[model samples]
Target: MSDFIGDWYALLVLLLAGFLPNEVWRMLGLWLGGGVDEESELLVWVRAVATAILAGVIAQILVLPPGALASIPPSLRYGAVAVGLMVFIVAKRSILAGVICGELVMLIGKWWLG
Candidate 1:
């Protein structure tokens, strides 16, 4: 414990390194955007870009899933997306419900098709 504590510089470096990566951006945002308007054009553009990034990530995972997901049938994947979309529409675009239904479809598919 004494030896470990003696490495204070290393611990400080580790703490700074870990905190600086993502937290710095968040801190900078708070500093620079003290009075950000939700309906502002720039904010709207940011939201659009964020949504695009989220959609792109989802699409990438669905299209080229790794490991176990890769073994799942393509038909299963398509059907899951269809069911999710339907649920999303019917549920008035509840993303949570849509994702749950999609995941449920995939889970059922794996079990039934096994």
Candidate 2:
């Protein structure tokens, strides 16, 4: 088991195969995206849709999470979101600050309650 796990050649092959498709598209996008207007209406709509999708996924996770997240109380998850959003708003809508504070509150709640 250890020999198979430690095989560098196999690891390299797996990593390359996993990244090849996405990385190729990313490289192509970098090459071709130069002419795209950042402020275009289509781009703005795309961003909005992407953000909405992300929010939907986060809501699903908090409301009906699986495995380890399921073990944590739902109320705690809701609290984490509330506090995180509050932090985000209080910190002038800094996404990083909100995410970090929300995660910290969840972790602390888990630790303190147990």
lDDT to native, each model: 0.89, 0.91
Estimate TM-scores for all models. Answer: 0.66, 0.62
Q: lDDT by residue for model 1 over 45-110, one digit each (tens)?
A: 988999999999988887898788899988899899999999999999999999999999999998
Considering every candidate listed, which one attains the maximal lDDT? 2
Give the runs in model 1 whose Cα sits over 4 Å from its true position.
Answer: 1-21, 92-97
For model 2, residues 1-114, the per-residue Cα lDDT tens digits are 987588887788877987786699679779989788889998899889989999999899989998899988988999998999999999999999999999999999999999
Q: Which candidate has the highest TM-score of all?
A: 1
